[model samples]
Target: MLAVQHCNNSALHVDEGFSNQTQQVLGVAPVRCRENLNTTTNPTAAGLSMTLGIVSNIIALIILAKAYARLRKRSKATFLLFASSLVATDLAGHVIPGALVLRLYISGTAGGLCNQSDATCHFLGGSMVFFGLCPLFLGCVMAAERCMGVTRPLLHARMVCTAHTKIVLVMIWLLALSVALLPFFHLGTYIYQFPGTWCFINVLDNTSITDVIFVLLFSGLGLAALAVALVCNTISGVTLVIARLRKKKCHRRSAKSHDIEMVAQLVGIMVTSCICWSPLLIFGLMSVIRSYSGSMGDDLETYRTLMVMGVRLATWNQILDPWVYILLRRAVLKKIYRITTGRSDLKGSTFRRWEISSFQNSMKSVINRN
Candidate 1:
């Protein structure tokens, strides 16, 4: 009986010991968590970025909406359709992620949203993927559209009607959506980016199969699209320059200045689009290569800084694209002025009509020359 009592007492002591150990572990957990929180995020920087993104996207959206309002049903061009689609993606990419970041920043939490695998994290990551790619692909489509307009004017006119453009836009969005959702389905992973401002695909200096496959595939596809766009833009620009030169050679004094200006404008759009997207993609490819080869080096700080800068640069595309559209499309600018000044002047309407007519006349000349 004494032995039995001792056994029961021993069991009680063991239970108490295990409970004490658990309590100690629990006590240490919060401290470790606090340390992690402090290290992972720069809340001030995040807030600043989010605020800027929010404000910029808002202004861009307002301008686009006002301008889109002015497009008469008969004048809905493919370029305008694609521009509207670009605005939608920019809105989603900037506003949604920016709002979430602001919420987390204001709540005074650090690092990720909730835990790493939480709903908010997935949403932000997926959104960053979707909206990030949307503009790029849409830009390519628009570039291709322009190429068609310049190179195959009759076919482009027949094929790229308003309904056809809408169908193409739908397809582009669906493709981007599919790619973005891959991470959520375990094909890839999305983790909180450093300084904890945003989330992106696995861009660490180490690689997994998923990371390698996704990065290479998407980067290849994106680069191909960008390349196609660059080529199209080059061809279109050269064609325009040649056309302008031919007109100058003929000594057609009328509208020669406008032709030169328009050619310059098209070249600028092409150059700007390429400049905005190229660095991030190139850096992303290099990072992936280094990760696979295990040559990432000891300077994680450099890698982190470069990654942050690359992301910011990529985001500049979203911010700048609307302004590019506004500056290049005279109709959009006219609408903005009218909206801002609340101008109901007949002169404004007539002037806009004249601008549209002039653009049509220019397009016809280009086609005829080609």
Candidate 2:
């Protein structure tokens, strides 16, 4: 009789376990796991997107390497090092997480992994945060470095070098990794996001003080970095303009032109990062606020849809970032200008020399003033 009772209890527990899994699969589980139940229904789209990202970043890396080879003897080598690191990080961002998602889709277990493997889910979630935030941080760093170079040439020359820049890059990666690892310490949670192809920090609802803090930290740092880049870039740009107005010579214009080119790239980085990352960071904060205020009443689905859209938008930053360096340089812009205006003579024209020389003189004036 006891044996029969034990068998019945075992059967009952098995049924309960199956029921819980079913609920989770159907999006009827707790709010934490209630993302859209559709799991990589369109593998083609996932595959194509990852392929394009991987290819573009690879091309960008190649271009950067060639440029670095040419610029190794130039003063801009430090800046190129930072740019190369950012591209490498973005490449890893695409490869590591992209490979995992592709594996899940290929194995026909896209949605089931989160339910079956906690470690896999956590790593995916952390990658999402780490990659998302690293570019923004690096953008700020690049902008600040350029700003100092333009506005305080003496101080910049004394302090910024390739070795120091490398140390800074390592520190930036460590900082991002530290934040990504917080969830493992019970400071936050990572769960499968909608369509069940990726995992990220849970932004749908608040469950603990640590979770709220983690979300705030991620979004807050991103927004703050953008803000700093904006200010530094603005000041650097204004200083350049002022220097240009103060100087009238054409000698050393190449140097000034190079400075302008670097600043221009920084501006491009700032704009791309703002457009790509703002929606997601803003949505994260809004979601938290709405959860706290009980205003998510009937718009939970809308919020989820927006979150997915935001994530998709953020991914574009990685792809767009490389192009900023590839296309915004002096050589490329001059070629494009010549093509559009049918002025091939612009390349070897006297005006081009004056333009370069004037830029160099203006830069000198600014440094002297500093």
How many residue pairs clash per model? 0, 8
Candidate 2, residue 71: Cα displacement in angstroms equals 1.8
Would you give me the overall lDDT of model 2? 0.76
TM-score of each: 0.73, 0.84
lDDT of 2 by residue, 1-370 (tens): 0000000111122244666778889988623232233432456666676777788889889988998897674557778888899898888888888888777667755543323327777888898899988999999999899999889988988899988998999999999999999988888888765555667777665445666788899999999999999999999899988776566364323336667888889999899999988998998778766766668888876886777778888888887888888898777887888888889787666348646665566567568768
Q: Candidate 1, residues 170-253: lDDT per residue as tens digits?
A: 999899899889876677677666555466777663467787777776677677777877787778777766765775699642
* Candidate 2 error regions (>4 Å): 1-35, 113-117, 248-255, 347-351, 354-370
Candidate lDDT scores, in order, read 0.62, 0.76
Clashing pairs in 1: none
What's the CA error at residue 234 for candidate 1, in Å? 1.1
- Between which residue pairs do clashes occur in model 2? 250-357, 252-360, 253-356, 253-357, 253-360, 254-356, 256-359, 256-360
What TM-score does model 1 achieve against the real structure? 0.73
